[model samples]
Target chain A: MDEMTIIFSAFLNGMGIVFTVPVFSAMMIGIVAGMIVGLIPGLGGLVAHILLIPFALQLGDPLAAIAMLLGVYAVTSQTDSIPAVMLGVPGTAAALATSLDGYPMAKRGEAGRALSASYFASIFGTLVATVIFILFLPLLRALVTKFSSPEFFMMVVLGLVMAASLSGRSQARGLLMAGLGLILSTVGQAPGTGDPRFIGPFLYLWEGVPIIPVLLGLFGVPEIIDLAARNRSIATSAPVKKVSGLWLGMVDCVKDWWLILRCSVIGVVTGFIPGLGGTVAEWMCYANAVASDKDKDSFGKGNVRGIIAPETGTAAHLPGAVIPTVAFGVPGNPPMAVLLGVFVILGVRPGQEMLTYKLDETFMMVNVITVGNIIAAALCLVFQKYLVKLCYVRASLMVPFILAAMVIGAGFSRLSLGDIAFFAGAGIAGYVFKHLDWPRVPLVMGLILGGIAEPYFFASIDRYGISWLYARPIVLVLEVMIIFMLFSTPIKAFAARLWKSGVRSEGSKHGDNT
Target chain B: MAITPENNLQPVDRNQSIAFGRRVDWIVSMIILIIGIAFIIMLQSLPGRATIFPWFITISIVFITATYVYGKYRNKAVWDELYDPDTKDGDEMADTGPAFVLAHRRGVLISLGSFLLVVAMTMVLGPEYAVPLFVFGSLLARKENWILAVLSGIGLWVIIHFVFGDMMRINVPVGFLFGGFN
Candidate 1:
């Protein structure tokens, strides 16, 4: 009864933050802005978080500031599918899998249906993930305590191994890009030794490369280039059709409630795995949909199941990501890392103490995530009917506006000529990678993991030595998972061949018996 | 069994572009290898513990690049078999031909040219002025309506200035050339 009271009060405290006029207004602004950002290819929540933090800090109330930023972060996953459905350009990495079916649906003039399904699944997934997060609070310590330095290092390795799965068919390219990203992470001044490894003459290198510009260059620029090159509107064949089937789309989401549940489970579980992040969650869920569904071949070809699976996974991972962050002070992704930085700026330390003494804040975070998800989904649904018309806007006209936004957005990170130059370079690199068929997401995953991985790896080695590091229960579990993931592709292939041979043998035996 | 270029990336004439396009992958591999070697060399000055992770990374990069290059030579058939199919389907705008240059050469030049123009302007006139110039110039370059382009340019500048500069108090750089503005 005492525990239940604590839970109830915490929930009320969170709701109080949302109801406060200033915080609620800020959240509304964030939700709307985040939706706009998510509609633009290559501008994701990270960009929004980076752009808004300086402003959020000035907002006076700490809870409000967090609410606003969390509002933005929560909405981004929900709306990133807008562009993926409309133009086949995912606004974020998590939306990449959504484009597989969403874009095809748009091409077929079913944009309204696809968008509606995404919004419904997104809200459903967020609600479910939040409930799971709240219910799992009691088990948090037991689950998180098993993770130490060595375990973190293994998790980083698992992230890299899992990158191969994202390659689709080009596993080698994915691994290579992961290596490249890891290498890029080591470019700045070494944390322990204070040795400037690659700064050269640029003082900016001391802090390492700013991720925003790099991301913009890698993801945003390529899309812009593609848009301009096409020299036409995004939707060629599809007219600005009425959102007639939107109701049916929502019905379809409910009909496929099992899929949403399963993918949400996939997302929440994968979210707990350090370094796997949203991209992996969405991709794994997407792969699951393709593998398990009866109409497997229809994926990447306007299947509503494809759209729902990724959108659900994207939303489900948010609470999962928040769990590790508030409980362990370890971020699940780059934006979450930025959020951790905000925690420090606000003079708050996140960890076990936060879970105990600061239960109200934790609950506020949970409620904010839940409320933010609802508001974002509602806003998208209201505007999607009109926003779907953006597909008819000429690429030439839209490209300039997006480019301006990208430039301004990238500039928010740092005001340096080097930053712009770095973006240009990254843009060139992005184009090359896109052309060469290299898996770009692995590179990004590597970049995200590298900074966190290094210190943990060195600390584990120094404290436990390599042999003992491998012996820890959690580390051993992670190792086994990594090894299995590494070989799972080949194992599945072999099994399929075995099944085929078995069928042939059975047929021969039946013929002989006859 | 030589690596057949992905159909989407292939030029209109495969035989004509293969000579140039096929070399792109090898060249990229060599460049990555050189970068790895350079990093390894740079790490030589660092303390041993600080250098360990970097060293591991650089060596891995070299090993991977070498293996990729060797496979290109020795197991061309595997490369041929493993190459991903063109999944773009009918998306005409998908990255095709030389992704760097792109099919519409003029469009690439205009977009990149306008980007450089914006950077150059920002250095002289600051983001406040440069943003409008970039928006208008790029829109004009795309041959859009003058009134619409101007309105958009001015509107975006207002949003960025008021929101970022005035409200958020983020320092938008005052150009060194504009001494009075600073």
Candidate 2:
């Protein structure tokens, strides 16, 4: 079939497949459940994904299974902003940047506005990504294949650089946290030689520290401690403004339409880079917002534009992430890796043939994503006014509930005594980091990317040697881009000044002539 | 650096703040440097390719941390300029009151004790009994109402039993108190 014909037919078939009772119902359930999971601090889509694995395996219909799973995945980044905005605790690492400005806004009684902005920005980002996905489908092979080990290395490097930029106060602390993360990633068995480094006596260490428990420890436990310390509700003020201020938040996003677009592009590009994933996407977008804005001081302090940038980045990356997963059979992120396993269980192979012959299935997944996000966004908008009240509950009352969630969340990793032990240890470390004013985000980025990057670094060294690795055109291009990114701020500042001077000179000349 | 509310640390004369900041920085950096060195030593003992990546990371860590400590020691201005918040001594620095017990030493001991009590109880009594006790103890320590605290404790245990133990089929650890009694 011709490309256009195939696209048309597949999209039509996909609509039929997803709109059915079983599929749509499953999708709705997944969306609602995912939102709940995502709203809870430190519990995110991965937990939801794991919980629904039984359903994914038991369901007979492929479309329904995919719809359910993809629905959960799509909504997580959207709803995860709740805890972020309300408590200054991110539900997931992807939502970390959201909390930068979001929590501040909530403190100022603008929780409604933040939620509304997140909802609108998420929808806009998802829609833009969907369009980008469809337009880029035919070109995905070339796009994905261009990134090999060297390029991947460069991308990881770029992520680390971005993490350093996120160091709100001190580059030293940010770099320190990031370095610690890299060290932590080396805990498991060696990538090449199968030699264990830091497992000690525990067999669990063979797989390295699980990201969930660590994240929960790092972000979740600290918030609980803060709550305990403050001895009050999340919102410090009484008489939080009437909650239906979503329209104002939505208007805020509309005002920063350019920021949304730029951040969405960042999301898409970061998503295309295989190992960087959503964690990096939002941070990079946040960094860009901080870099570009004249009033940089307002960021990390209740700026609506801060919320818009990260939310858009978080939402836009989903479809972009799937492109490489579909076209190259390489999972773009961890959740995508899980979805790839689901695909295999459903008797669908993902490679060039799957991209071509199973175009219908691919489109079905895409449609699920698009529809799922819209539904999630709408539902969030509908319920967020009520949900915003969570900010008002006394921390004393909330602690038991949150503590239960935290303990259970730790157990979700392995259901062993060790998981709790590790969580406590990591929790203490997280507390220390937060206490020391260390930027915690880079530590996480380092942990995630270190595992991916180390293997590529070794492989590139062993196979092609250092010179050949650097000689690759793509590697060279990415390195140049990294350098450019490093200096772009000063370059832009200089250009701005030049333009102003030129304009002033032109005006002066015009005055003389007159 | 611009001081925001997040960095609610009181501003003093720049020199005093710088000295305070440097003292904390030196301690943290030294600790990190020690950790890095320890890791490097540990990795050095590992065999073959396992040593390679870990060694690289530990060395980088050592370099960064050492540099941080040395810089702070040599120039207090750098430390002051980088100072954002002092989370390390957050409890001591926090506003003190009856409600803010967690910021006090007594409250901290209670909180830490409750956590340890939970761990010990879980090992002896399993999650069903231990979790609620821990929750109740913690809430009560935080000065919550007794009835509400006890009720919340029970409610939390029930949820854990039903949700995780039953629905998710997680193997809730049977404790020594059970003595292998199923």
Pairs of colliding residues, candidate 2? A435-B87, A435-B88
Q: Model 1 — interface RMS deviation?
A: 6.2
- What does the lDDT read for residue A404 in candidate 2? 59
- Lowest lDDT sum, 10 consecutive residues, model 2 chain B, at B93-102
lDDT of 2 at A94: 79
C-alpha-based local distance difference test score of model 2: 0.69
List the pairs of residues colliding in candidate 1: none
Error of 1 at A242 (Å): 5.2
Local accuracy of candidate 2 as per-residue lDDT tens digits, A439-478:
6667766776677668778877787887854688877876
TM-score of each: 0.78, 0.69
Predicted model with the maximum TM-score: 1
Candidate 1 lDDT tens digits, A288-307: 88887898889989899998
Candidate 2 displacement at residue A116 in angstroms: 7.0
